[model samples]
Target: MPRGTDHRPRYEQVAAELREQILTGDLAPGAQLPSTAQLMARFDAANATIQRALKSLKDEGFLNSRVGKGVYVRNQPPLVIDTGAYLPPDGSFSYELIDVETLSPPADVAAALGLADGEEAVRRRRILLHDGQPLELSASYYPADIAANTALSKPGKIKGGAPKVLAGLGLPQRAFVDRVSARPPTREEVEMLDLPVRTPVIRQLRVVLSDDDRPVEASVLVKGAHLYELQFRRLVSDPEANDV
Candidate 1:
């Protein structure tokens, strides 16, 4: 990935460069950034441009200023949620099951799960906790045909989580397609995640697929932008993937 390929402004280009370094661990958390003069020399950017770039990172929760001290990468590592590790950690963390019921899913969820209009789904809402602090709010949906006679349709917690239960039903999850975005949290989400302010939240819509790309589950997740990061990798080595 070359910086010259991006047509964004110079400051955004610079910020993107630094942001990649941070994300790829070229610059570790809490690492002190190079001096502005040094950065200016590196990016061939003016003082104002450099400051704007740094400010962008600050606004995005990527860096923090110490006044007397120069800006440093945020100390707390973002909770990593990848494809295989999408579920909350079982042993290291805990969660609260807010509600479980068979109800009509949202439009997007119904579409993702291949449900027809007016088709009901099993809705399971939960809140994940880390170190006794609310970390994320998740709402999962399953089609009635798939969840019937299963723990998912019940009004109690499912042992070993929903994935395991689905597996037992011979509809094991094989892959995930995640759509990530950011927006204002709802009143319920704010209270559930215990957000101190009305800051924008990172939201993800994840569709879990079984064999033949059959979607078995769809989940909507909302979390504090300051609390988590999403990582992805591609197997294709070129622009075209033969088996993507």
Candidate 2:
């Protein structure tokens, strides 16, 4: 293909096209890729450029090359996460406490919690691990008035989770809303999640409300885009479908 007006490097352009094929199942899992020489001709690139493109995909876990054979797409299935569940960690999951501090929240979080300017919130930062692997980075904030001296303000992992702690404090969570988006990962997130180069991340901002629509908790959950996909279920005939 001609470079034309596309500004990306030759190898990157080739890799991007291959990546799309793999993602869309045009190149199915376990299916061998075309020969290196064939790819060179197809992309109108040099041998080294084709090799670089293949290397990039392999580095990203999209392809694997055999010793004497050739490259094949890996059988990697994205993890599907139920967006409605708010369950505590069980035997297979664990939490690593990152920090617990009282600080002014980000603008969005401050607005979610209805905090006045300069008003501080207690933040509990931690990594949720599955099978001892980092699955998500979470930072949960609670109004200082409600969480100041509670376990939510501590560095140790709570027994059940923040929900139980909040319930005990008479602020049981009745409802919650999630706003999710996808974007490039932050430097800290890339290191923490051990993400591959060029990998994006999914950001979920959740607000848990109690009685009288009082916001009890606001949380930021980040996950590697390549590793997980959000799943939401709904009834087709439900009147609240529009709300969803």
Candidate 3:
């Protein structure tokens, strides 16, 4: 077929061709895709057409690529994160703290919280369920200075969970900022969460700060495919309120 000659877009045709291969088992889970040059030859199309097709698949959660590695089939689903509206009376969702560990913070994590490189921190992993369905895998981290002095620093205290223990420590409830993104889960997450190889997962990174503007906790939440939705609202501040 001529390049960009399809009545429908050529890129769409290219994406459809790859999708067919995936459905037919020709491109199995973890299979590497042909190189761009190779695809150009196979599809008898230009580099731009092949790239557009690859971009479509990637956006649809069907492919992933590393800096030095070629594209590979993503063996997981997208997580649906519920960014529920922030109402005055909303309460924290129920969760079961499954495991806790104190370890050196990862580079990306340390950077996110502005901690020194190689600093020690507490890692708490929890399984959050709603109505008995696994909703999210939540991992939270606390800086050593704060966490070390509390019950949360201990080995077994995570079982008591976060909100209760934090309240016990006298840290009043404060503000939270949530950042959202979407991508396919890693191979291990796919198996652990019992999701299909093609499912995409939604990732929510929440940073909770104390009233004094100090970083208290950071949480990474991964939700299962099509399980939840996120909502946001704009709040207008009243200028005529008391200035006293």
Candidate 4:
């Protein structure tokens, strides 16, 4: 912890040490980090180096500075998302209904939902919360004809989720297709998610097909990639194992 002990820049050395501590869970989520004075003393580094080290972690999304509160480790444990599963996979999550409106679906969304050109769809937008922090943005598109006068079109939380709503309309989803990608977050997404600049997001485009193979629903989810992981359960055939 002496100044210039390592050939690397003092700030990088300090940042590297702190980064390891966070990755190793020595500093747990919401744990307040050491004060600048403490870090400077421990590292034998100047104020500028100590400040730069803290800023590095902040830009990496490992730490956040509160206006009144001191710097603390961000509660960014990866959320486990089951592909094609119902929203709020567990009870620990809180959700907010951002918007529900009839709008001209984006070109790709319209195609996924099997809507014609210029055709409108009911768009339902919701955001999921964990520990009172936003974790995901989900938007589902339903063909106007399919959603009219149903719970899907209503501007309120659906009692049984989208699947149940479709089931009520005699169009239960028999299968779903999901395609995932990642990209830099937009300005609006940065604000909505309270994410660090330059952070990338995971995008999952899902299409739900009815029993007759009709694409009844399509949804686009933008998730905090740094703070989430996707999990899937697969069943593989092993007929030989059945022989006894």
For each candidate, how many residue pairs have backbone atoms clashing (under 3 Å)?
0, 0, 14, 0
Per-residue lDDT of 1-244 in model 4, one digit per residue for the tens?
5665568778878988987787667998789998888998999999999998888778877889988779999886546778857565567787799999999988888888888788899999998887788888889999999999998998989886888999988999899889899999988788898886556899999999998789988898998766777887767599787788
lDDT of 3 by residue, 1-244 (tens): 5576558678778888997786556898688998999999998989999998888788656788877988997774333233542211323445666777888776656766668877878888877655455667878888887788677776554444566676666665487778888998987667656664455788878777676766677878787644445656546598567466
Candidate 1 residues 97-187, lDDT tens each?
A: 9898888999999999989888999999888887788888889999999898889988778888898998998989899998889999889
The worst-scoring run of ten residues by lDDT in candidate 1 lies at 83-92
Residue pairs in clash, model 2: none
Better of 1 and 2 by lDDT: 2
Give the Å shift of residue 218 in candidate 1.
0.4
* lDDT to native, each model: 0.85, 0.88, 0.71, 0.85
Deviating ranges (above 4 Å) for candidate 3: 1-94, 155-161, 167-170, 238-244
lDDT of 2: 0.88
lDDT of 1: 0.85
**What are the models' TM-scores?**
0.68, 0.84, 0.56, 0.71
Name the best candidate (by TM-score): 2
Best by the lDDT measure? 2
Question: Which tens-of-lDDT digit does each residue in 74-163 have in candidate 2?
Answer: 986556788876434367777788999999999999999999999999999989887888879999999999998899988888998898
Lowest lDDT sum, 10 consecutive residues, model 2, at 85-94
